[model samples]
Target chain A: MEKQDQILMKKQNKTYVLELIKNMAPISRMQISKNTKMSPTSITRIVGELQEQGFVKETKLVTSGVGRKATLLDVCGDVLFTIGVELDKAVLKIGIVNYVGGMIDLQTYVRNPLESYEETVQNINDKVKNIIEQNAIPVGKIIGLAVGLPGSIDYENGIVRVAEQLRWKDVHLVRDLSKLTSLNVVIDNELKMKIIAENTVGKAKDSKSSILVGIGSGIGSAILLNGEVHRGESNNAGEIGHTVIDPNGNVCSCGKFGCLCTYISEGAILADAKKMKDISSIDEVFVAFRDGESWALNILDRTATYIALAISNLACLYEPECIILSGNLIDKMPEMKQQIEEKCERYMWEPIKKNLHIVHSSLGSQGVVLGAAIQAQNSLFDIN
Target chain B: MEKQDQILMKKQNKTYVLELIKNMAPISRMQISKNTKMSPTSITRIVGELQEQGFVKETKLVTSGVGRKATLLDVCGDVLFTIGVELDKAVLKIGIVNYVGGMIDLQTYVRNPLESYEETVQNINDKVKNIIEQNAIPVGKIIGLAVGLPGSIDYENGIVRVAEQLRWKDVHLVRDLSKLTSLNVVIDNELKMKIIAENTVGKAKDSKSSILVGIGSGIGSAILLNGEVHRGESNNAGEIGHTVIDPNGNVCSCGKFGCLCTYISEGAILADAKKMKDISSIDEVFVAFRDGESWALNILDRTATYIALAISNLACLYEPECIILSGNLIDKMPEMKQQIEEKCERYMWEPIKKNLHIVHSSLGSQGVVLGAAIQAQNSLFDIN
Candidate 1:
């Protein structure tokens, strides 16, 4: 083998051993060798290197079948940390996340809807500094920062093409934030980030492939397959909001008539409620529905049907193991979940309806924040 | 490195070199080394082995910028052949396909809708024997056999879960066929195979990701991403026919209301036409439309609109680089393609519509056969 080939092989072996130890903690060196088919000398060398770097350590002693004791290896959970930020139209959430995707500390701030891109970047930078100082975290231990927002994100270059909710376009979010804090920054669509969190530690943790549907101000979905996001040609794979379901239905903000979002989105429901009884929020519509008002019942029932239709459509197209429902419409109106699932049973294709796990998001609002931090850690410390 | 690792590395290097030569033909060994970052000795050894195996041969000579002449390598296109079969309700198509996905010979036969699975298998076995004997081809050069049909295929296990058109359920097609002919058999959904052909050599050749929509007696779609079919949890990822578009619309055969297929499929159009006149086929409706019949025009116009709506919905959900329309509804009525494109222009989401290439299938009826043969070749000769 060439010298370069030998070096490459060693690096790969080290990464393999490290990942095995991290994922299968309290595993003996013999167990790693048995699972990986690696030689004992190679495992020992890699584990020693990982221990020297403080990423791994000896955990506990376990008895083998032959009555021999062996030390188990595990990853040091606090060796590295990441900053996750969720940037939305009305809120900015930041969290310090550890190696295991758990938040050490989280803070939420009310964001001005009309804030400029520059002002938002400055505010995020200041908050990040304050949080680090307040926690007294060592600077060297911070891996990077990841921001999740609603937009057509140029993930490779960290550019936001259009954020309808934030009314911002052509913002270089990653470059600006990285420059402000001197930390590596990554960005992705908020829904994509949320699905990653769901797949990692929430409702979709056991699903090999899953879809996360967010039906708030806009109706959108994100597909997670084998731990990777299926971002379509232009990071627009799950833009189901603009899909027309009724030709004669209401006009959507996207200039199409009878779009799926026009029937099921939170804004669309509120608009319908306002037309009926001068309602200002979706909660008022729910209250009226609970009070047995015909107008509210009509609006809510139709919305639930459309939501079901969207779920049916998603199931037909994705056929994922699970479909996770998230966003404001689902989170705030938990009572409507049953209505949507019942309608889904009526609308879904018979073959697909079987064995399909349609569940609500378990992480709720912290999904994006946790997902972004996990993504940041993954980006900074890739084993594959 | 272990002895086994050495052998594995050598095998991988051989496949890499063979693929490089196959994809970039008439390439010199020096250029291969430069592109692959492999030493000249390793490239020479692999190339030598490939030449000995009759898979590759030296072709024309090329001169570098320095005027140094070097012999280029090329694959032997006739080295291996595969049998491709397309099984449908009304017909069966069989072809002998070469290594480069070219059909050496093709034959078609009528199929009974209610034919038993065993009878179909026997028929296919006879056809394969006749084709091979007629060509006077040697048995050793034949790779395998692949069959594409309309249904949910358990591709890994080579079982047909359901073929609604053919009325087949739980048929062990691959096992039975292989047992009869002593050749490896693979099966996949016809649309999935069609899209594979489309991605390989048809309209979607340049598309990174694409969706194929088939509108006929039934409606279905297939997704191709990065050279692999996206078969979902149960090989039903693109079963878009049962997706509910209008809750108050007509009932679909799947017991759903207002399915996309109910408005656009050939049977749907024929059903609507028979309501006004005694028309029994879709071709008659097209003829009447061409002859300027008012009722015919109304039906065809609505069908075209629904076809456009399905395309728009596909575009919204997948955001693929292109969407290819296929099946009898599209192949027989070429004139409607323009009308559908016009409707798609009006209905598509503005952002996704801008760069999307909505095109008709270039392979037409031969797609499934060609793709099946290609898949057979890939399966029998996998080096990765």
Candidate 2:
């Protein structure tokens, strides 16, 4: 009844219409109206406003039954931009991503193994600013920047609760970044960010629910629920590596005994290799295993089985349509794919096994930065 | 532009408004408007129409601002009813539930352990019709019925994929029941239904996301995502029991090795007891443990450890705020609750350990029927 409420209602309707178009890219107004159950007039009005605001644009034409063409509207993918940074133990990656998850500018740099959280933030801030200037990116065009760290992060508050890989604890990452730069900042766990990226533009594009399992120095998994990564009560969900596999077998870095990571992480695999051979890295171990060395084969086979078991467990719990494997181990050891899938099939509940699809992460190393970028865009645009 | 489209939009908005009031319960129109961002006039019109349709009513008056009363709308809880039935091997339960998940009538009956699916369906149909008629429940006032079965069900098609406990496989339960009755039917796993009920009106009420782990003849768990049971790609999402704990352990009922259930299910405990002494049921095992028998205590302690590990793994994956234990084993042996919680706390990642809470299912035996009723109501109403 009130004037202010009517305006709010209009704004809400506009946001809904814009979101609908964004998700259903290259959509016709008729399709939008049908899906939203909105009147054609309302759809037209909202779309017109969106176009005028430079948020949407006419892109293509779809052939209709009558040999006529229906004009399609798409969210202007490059109209807004976001910066994504992935802070790993030995490497740092940055990308400027567009509204549609397109990377505009990207780079990776070697990370100082012993850099303090504050020093790392400062270096990252300088690089991001330099990149923006180099590319002549307009300050107003870029939304907030997002950082993905390898740790249990308080994503909502941008605090890293514990990053065992980075040896960082309770670091107020976003606040630190925000103080050093004008850009607003968002932060989340690296695996969580990777899953979001995969859901947006990779193997999980058609999946409303999926899981991404990362098996690098530390193992972790993240769930994508209806297109958003699930951040549970404390953003520590998907810490699967710490889940016990053999409660009495061996102690994990977290001081827990027989964690899943102890048997399957890249570090774990390397440690296994070092016990009998002069192998220094996972690549050497994988090479030895692929060439049919008995010791290496045994270790790889067991880890592959564990990975499959973990996938089966995740499938049963998350009921995900797709389980994607990422991180260094998966990227390097393509031979283990068949082994893991076979093992997962052997372990999975028969019904879930029938529905589950296991795959390699399509985004791979690019997922973290793109995911962080999209998350930043979401934060600035209130996209959800 | 068209009358049909206008009418469709009006109905959609009406459904939205009614669902808002139903979920918010005892909320004023002003609060609804504020939350939904609808114009007050639109809210009043929708509320008035819903009130006239007997879907909602003014049920409360809250004193506000100096001696004024603000009237609140509530869903007409009894205006619609649903029949909920839980089917297990030895016992069956039926409940007549109202719109707001309140139970009007509840009864339990003995079931033939070796009955055929068709025979079981026939008996249930006959009893359901008789109960409805005996209670003078009008056919029009009641929504379709829902059945909770102990199986991996193809919920969308109402087919039981596998139910090791019930010895069921690929039974067209819904079609068989629907063929015999005028009402449509919906079916899901018993654990999934229980979690829904608990999330709505039991121990999980305070939690937006929670897990209900039921330790009965078969160990099973279900997740509630924002008050709705998460049915994964094939409605077999929370098959945590079948998730492997040991690749070389013992074979489980589901033909898997070292399933979490092999360590914790009532059948497993009974089998363990049998391995030591002549014991027929889990009740005997619990009695032995309570009486300080080391054999029984050892079986229980191992199962409790596995149960705690399973809970810790689930918490890591699902990030559930609360984990609720259910079924007869937990219902009868309340002392195991503390031991399991302690074990889970010991194994959990520290951050999650601080955030997670373990509790017993408050609804206990009543969860299944009530949950099925609410699910049936959801199907008929499109409440989500």
Candidate 3:
């Protein structure tokens, strides 16, 4: 136990040093020791191993106030890269991400809606190799690949249990994809990944716990605490969209009636718009609402009310300091932000209202791709 | 930094040793070392500090397997006591709790509803001393006092912010009590303390995160995570009763329409029962339902359905493994347990429901008193 404790402490110190260098590079070992409050001897031992493993390197010395040169340490970011994929039915976006969660290059691939599972895997394989060749990056530099998609994903077993959007069930996502791409693979729900990105580098970076309320293809939420996404017992912790709100209302795909999503989702708004005429998409509803169409305004009013209800429920449950509203619905109807905020004030439990700050997703449509990559980097690099 | 780390580690080991001694008395040092997998030297050092502090004592030797005598340690449980008080408008229950969270002595006092706040404080001051002297316990052994009551309590400031049951606002409870007793005083909501006792020794003993859903005077909830109650930024995290379930329904006292409590709370059930006749209490409604009264049954059905809805929403958002259904509503009508369980199945979001174990509070009415004592012990003894 004594030896084990020492080893654990050493590993923790090493990770802390690595993280410090990642966040505050061009820093000297003395400064790292000062910031970490670790003894110089401990810092030397950890830094020595890091340097030998090519994870850190000595940068050019800079003269201090006393005209004394001090060596600066930097992370070798170019030595590793991760592939983050945002998958959907007809389109998938792939990004080459580095240690700092910055995407080197992003490319979108179009796929046939009727493409078989094997054909999709083969396409991804060919595209990945092409992207690597185009960037002239070594195949060895890619540590792992992570796929973010819609639906229930068994993260631990690497299986897509059910992806309603892709019309896929029981797909061995990691097993098949890792074999084709020849890299380690991880799969997770898109909203979970998006919250991970938001919690790590986006809007919720400073929050201890935060909720990312997604209003896209469907209404749902993802929770992030500390730096890890809260995946409940079955990795389906934040399935609020299916929570029955009006027992006598619309039936959901899950066979439940009056689910919150039925009243506030993009599809729900378009369905209401269809009662007047053939309104094909959410964009038309937004246009009509902007043109002072009373019908569209009523639909939005109902949607905003339910949105506030859902937000209040979430606030009561988690009491997280921040709630990020994202998804296609939020991105398109930015004006609704004020209306939703006002409704929240009405529906919110009084005592807890002042403690919360609800805001729009700062990452916008790019959160999923970046989030997928961030998860891959955190897992593969073990920098957590 | 190294010295400080060592000091911290030593204190942690000391606390761990004390806890082990409390749980496993009459055990040899060698056995403790082996069970903890800690070095013999570390165990010896920690045990020495515990003995010096008079918290632990070396007991009589016992014969070992080889016929050699082995020294054993035991915790002096009665060396310290904590005062636990459960307060309401007209009555207050006080208990002297020991190390095992056992209430050694209990006494209840009735107060004049029309009496001034100072007179009530004077009555409590006299009774506390009377109980201590009758039991012959030294005042020096009383580490601290903790009060549990209904309301939005500012725990840090030890103030009863708003207790509707007592019709009190901005009452400086700890300031008055600490002056009367000359002991440290901590005050918190009754639901918060109940969940603490439940989390530490009751139904949620083995669960990582659990919520206590209270449905007594009103509907509310308290959350426990990793042994700590998650008091939100305003110390009002689990205010689920105020969650708006219907925008078009009845307005709540908080000025919110269709609050969950307005449909499922004990007060709500009695309110509906009054329309058919003059049902003044939840107990009368329960008796009427048991007698096969259709109106009473209908009222219960609606209440159960809404209870299920609130629980489903809670399960979806928190995803905690255990949800302890409590409050006077469950206590008086135990058969409602079956009704609620069945209703939960109907409304629960499919995935999360399977992972949850909804049960009634095992500690029942004694939870608040014991929980208050535990908090006092944890805070004053610095055992946490």
lDDT at A92, model 2: 90
What TM-score goes with each of the models? 0.88, 0.84, 0.90
Model 3 segments beyond 4 Å from truth? A1-16, A28-30, A36-66, A69-77, A89-91, A109-120, A382-384, B1-14, B36-66, B69-74, B89-91, B108-123, B382-384
Q: What share of the reference contacts survives in each candidate?
A: 0.71, 0.79, 0.60
Better of 1 and 2 by lDDT: 1
Q: Write the per-residue lDDT of candidate 2 for residues B21-114, one digit (tens) a residue.
A: 8788889888899988889999999888887878989975663676557788888887889999999888889889988788888888988889
User: Cα deviation of B374 in candidate 1 (Å)?
Assistant: 1.8
Candidate 3 lDDT over A250-297, as tens digits, reads: 887777778897887777888889998687978999999999999989
TM-score of A-chain in each prediction?
Answer: 0.94, 0.91, 0.90
lDDT of 3 by residue, B179-297 (tens): 99898898999889888889778998867888898887678889876667888776777888777777778888888888887887766777878999876767788889999999999
Best candidate according to DockQ: 1
**Per-residue lDDT for B1-384 in model 1, tens only?**
999999898888888898899889889998999989999998998888889888899987674677768888888888889999999888899999987777999999999888888899999999999999999889888989999998788999999988878888898998999999899999999988888788778887866788999877678999987767888888999998877777789987777789887887777888889999987778899899989999988888888888888889888888888899998888888888999999998898776887798888878788889989988887887653
Pick the winner on TM-score between candidates 1 and 3: 3
In model 1, pairs of residues that clash are: none
Q: How many residue pairs clash in each candidate?
A: 0, 1, 0
State in Å the error of residue A274, model 2.
1.3
